[model samples]
Target chain A: SQLAEENSWALSVHEGESVTVNCSYKTSITALQWYRQKSGKGPAQLILIRSNEREKRNGRLRATLDTSSQSSSLSITATRCEDTAVYFCAGMGYKLTFGTGTSLLVDP
Target chain B: EAAVTQSPRNKVTVTGGNVTLSCRQTNSHNYMYWYRQDTGHGLRLIHYSYGAGNLQIGDVPDGYKATRTTQEDFFLLLELASPSQTSLYFCASSDPRWGGRAEQFFGPGTRLTVL
Candidate 1:
């Protein structure tokens, strides 16, 4: 079983729309990280929110961690075609467990 | 700039052939990891090492072997190549909490195809 799992497999939204991707984990984590993967590229870290922190923002991206619920969310504001990619949330401690990921397509 | 680089960015080999993928990290981090990515399964850890000459098993380590020869290099080996192993391979290096850093840097990745 996957330690972390994303809510949706794929999402499509027009440019300028807002999008959110959710993730749930089976075990407790020291921190949860959000990563973005473009086509033919490896995953890149977007945000890292610790267990104690509830929310974090990086430019157009916002991430919220709910340790009580064992879930997290990544929100992209004013989406652009350049923002299109697969987003993954990973739980980290001694080891990192990643979810299947949510593929976001921002159509122009 | 901290960078992780993988060699033989693309490869094609026949079954039963021996293959070796190389990774180098210039960041000199203490932790290095190997992962394979598939369409529906995302990225799964194969192996990791904390420092030179150290190895640790990950979630999916079956039929795979890893060696960390130096602080800057880690290698993944397939003694008998199988089609099931055909996938994109990524090498990452991270500074462990003990090293006082929380970020992992990823390489460009290697695309291997076993026929």
Candidate 2:
């Protein structure tokens, strides 16, 4: 069983468009993290929201955490081709559990 | 900028051969971790260490060995590699600052192919 799972398998958007990827988890967590992995690269930390915080933002990326629902979402605004990557939401309890990931493809 | 780097950006090995993946972090973080990424499974933790000379078992630690030699270096050892071990390996470091609210910084990743 997976501890964290994302909503969409793949998403495509044109430049200047906005896209949102949702995620859900099964157990309690201390923090939730959003990571971006480009092609042939390792995952890079985008945001880290604690259980006490509801929302966080970094540049054009926004992340929201809902502990009550055991879910999270990552939204990208003004999308560009460079923003195309696989996004994963991870739950950090004693250890880290990652979602399957949502692949975002941005067309220019 | 603070970063974590992994050696042997790409590696190809035969089955039953020995493999050693090295990682180093300049962020001076306390907690280090090793994970492997597959196509469908995303990332699964193989092992971790809090500091020098400490090893912690992760969810999937069956056929892997790890060593934390210093504050900056952590190594993953595969004594007898198998085809199943073919995947992208990542090393990360996390500073437990801000009441354990800090995020983990990952390395560039090592792509290993076992034949």
Candidate 3:
């Protein structure tokens, strides 16, 4: 069983469009991190939002964390084909617990 | 950036076979981890270590044993391989000083199959 899970299984959007992936966790966490995994590669961290912070941004990626609801969202703007990857939200508790991930395909 | 590498990017074995997955980290971080990824289960922790000769049981550690021989090397042993063990495995390293906030750096990954 997964302690954290993404709400969407898959999403599709055209290049230059915007997309959002949401996640929910079952336990308390110190921080939440967003990671992207491309085909045949390991995941790489994209953003980290702390429990005390509501939002954080890095380049074209923005992440919002709501402790009240134990949910988080990652939004990408002006998406590119390179952004076609599986997005995962990992909760930083005593140990890192990851979600199943949301597969996002950016079509040109 | 940190460097983590896993050997034998792909492996295949039979039931009850012996398999060992190797991982090495170049960056001198104090913590290392092993995780398995399946279609429905994204990434489940198998084992972790804070230092050499130290091992910690993770969320899903059944049928898996891990050893940290040195600061840079970590190994996962599957003495009796099973079909359910067929999945993509990853290795990661982080600094424990940061506790839960520590960002983990991952290796490329190893795909394993069991008959």
- Candidate with top DockQ is 3
Q: Give stretches of model 1 more than 4 Å off.
A: B98-101
Best by lDDT: 3
| Residue B66 in model 3: lDDT | 98
DockQ of each candidate, alpha-carbon based: 0.57, 0.63, 0.73
Each model's TM-score?
Answer: 0.96, 0.95, 0.98
Scored by TM-score, the top model is 3
RMSD of each candidate? Answer: 1.5, 1.5, 0.9
RMSD of 1: 1.5
Which digits, one per residue and each the tens of the lDDT, describe model 1 over residues B48-84? 9999999999889997999999999999999999999
Residue range with the least summed lDDT across 10 consecutive positions in model 3 chain B: B95-104
DockQ of candidate 1, scored on C-alphas against the true complex (2 decimals): 0.57
lDDT of 3 by residue, A11-96 (tens): 99999999999999999999999999999999999998999999999999999999999999999999999999999999998888
- How are the candidates ranked when ordered by DockQ, highest leading? 3, 2, 1
- Sort by TM-score, top down from the best: 3, 1, 2
lDDT of 2 by residue, A10-53 (tens): 99999999999999999999999899999988888899889999
